[model samples]
Target: MPPKAEYIELKKSIDTLIEEVATVKEQQKTIMALVEQLDQTQADNLEKDKKIAILENRVADLEQYTRINDVIITGLSIKPRSYARAVTPENGGEPAELDVTSTERQVAAFMQSKDIQLDCNNIEACLPLPKRGTNGKPSVVLRFVNRKHKIALLKQGRKLKGTNVYMNDHLTKRNADIARKARELRREKKIQQAWTANCKVFIKLNGTPENTKVLVIRNIEELNEYDV
Candidate 1:
């Protein structure tokens, strides 16, 4: 071959080799960044799992206490007791107590201690006083305090059937409902991950939307021969 043509061919080969090396370096940087992002995501997911577990256990404990309270009041046939004191000292009135049981008294005291203002206006009407079900089972009724602050109250709670208390079905049902909500939250997180991954790939590929660099590379063979 002629010396001039031979020299030109060698220069072309050198240029191709340089391009290949630059492409490889770019790919390596992209991969390293992806790995770091994945590690951070995994750590965040672990924290979320811990938080969910704590919330689940707390809800279960609350459900158990609520169901048991219903049983106590129902079996005892205790009416909800209330107290009233006269402001006028000259009248010398007595502190009126109702035919409520020990369990009812404890629950009312607990509610008052929590600063949950009770709507005692229709207390008698809202009964079998928040503890009795017409079908003769205990129920956890959601009642409102001061026109707000909705709370769970028990009714018709009798201990029967080998240490099991007959309460309304909603008690166990609430736990299942909460689990469904958690599943939806996890699904949203998956979508967010996909969106983030796309964003990262776009940033690394860096080109105008009209001429993205990743799209310009047609095949693995072209990428290997690319000029950096």
Candidate 2:
């Protein structure tokens, strides 16, 4: 009611309002700091993921490089009876049946028949893969002493298309799965052609090599890049 009493009451109200404003400013500062920390954490996680991806790719490249000198031959006629028989050397040496080189010699002979310049000496190692079922002959997985020999065989393999003999580059399991899926895509009419060369998978969506762009499939996920 009096001027002095009214002035004191207004001063008290102003002080209370100032305290509430200060509290709101402090809360705003705390919220902004939390948001900044979250942004930094996300950026750090993204950097870590990129590094892991780079390391994985390098390991895959090394695995493929080791298999560059290997190839697999399927549909070769190798009888089970002669599977353990010894093979005589070209120099007219004794029949070395205990050595179990009959398969190697047979594979060497088969390659020669195809006009691919190779011999038992060129074969660094040879092992017959188990036959899928009871009927067909087992596929031969072989490594060459020289990379050139593998390349020569691959180049000459195209002529054996109509015949039972088939050859393919030896690929890592990851790459093999990718190749298998690529071929499946081709058979499904989703792609023009898909094959493996030097242990790398490739796909041609459509069109000729001149017009169409061929894609190299490094990982299986890349297969999804094509629309068809």
Candidate 3:
């Protein structure tokens, strides 16, 4: 070939190579932009997950706070038939319905027997829970005008341990389940002592120097934290 023809062919090849480099650079820029967008989306999702966790914790705290003023008395013997007959007329007439008054009087008498020194006026409400099966005595739920009186009653309840009386905080169903599990753990020798107070389940491990561990259980998912 002639020299002029060779020079023209080389110049055309150089132009094509430059265009290819520019295209590659544009593709690189697009890929980088997509990667940056993905990073931002992941960060936003992480922050949202954190906020959701915080909100869930706050809701649990609020639920527990509502039950702080309530207390439960178990092992209180209640013979529905006897009590029903006691308030009835001797003429074999219709049995008088047992109202909250009768239940309150019974609770007051129990407290007196325990020497708890609680005023009847301080009791805001009293009701008996449904009898469980045949052997379980119906528990009594007591609401006080103030939490202080409830605390006092609970403190004095220690004296009735040897007897058939037991007292505990009135926890919600979720906390109650946790408390039951905690006791089961203790029975299995996994923990030294497990109890509920202020609607929280506490576990004390044997040979541990620290105090009891507070379990913050929300659902079955959270139980994994306690190795449950």
Best by TM-score: 2
What is the alpha-carbon RMSD of candidate 1 to the true structure? 21.8
User: Candidate 2: which pairs clash?
Assistant: 86-97
Q: Judged by lDDT relative to the true structure, which candidate is superior, 1 or 2?
A: 2
RMSD of each: 21.8, 5.1, 5.9
Give one digit per residue, the lDDT tens place, for model 1 in 185-208: 335441111111110111113345
State TM-scores per candidate: 0.35, 0.74, 0.65
Tens-digit lDDT string for candidate 3 (18-48) = 9999999999999999999999999999999
Q: Please provide, for model 2 over 1-228, each residue's C-alpha lDDT reduced to its tens digit, 9 standing for 90 to 100.
A: 899999999988899889999999999999899889999999999999999988988898898888899988888866543434455686477555554447787787777777776666788998788887778666888899998888977888877867788889988888988998898888887889998877889898876678987889988988865535
Clashing pairs in 1: 131-154, 131-155, 131-156, 138-156
Query: lDDT scores for all predictions?
Result: 0.42, 0.82, 0.77
Model 2 weakest 10-residue run by lDDT: 78-87
Model 2 segments more than 4 A misplaced? 1-21, 75-97, 109-117, 130-137, 162-165, 207-210
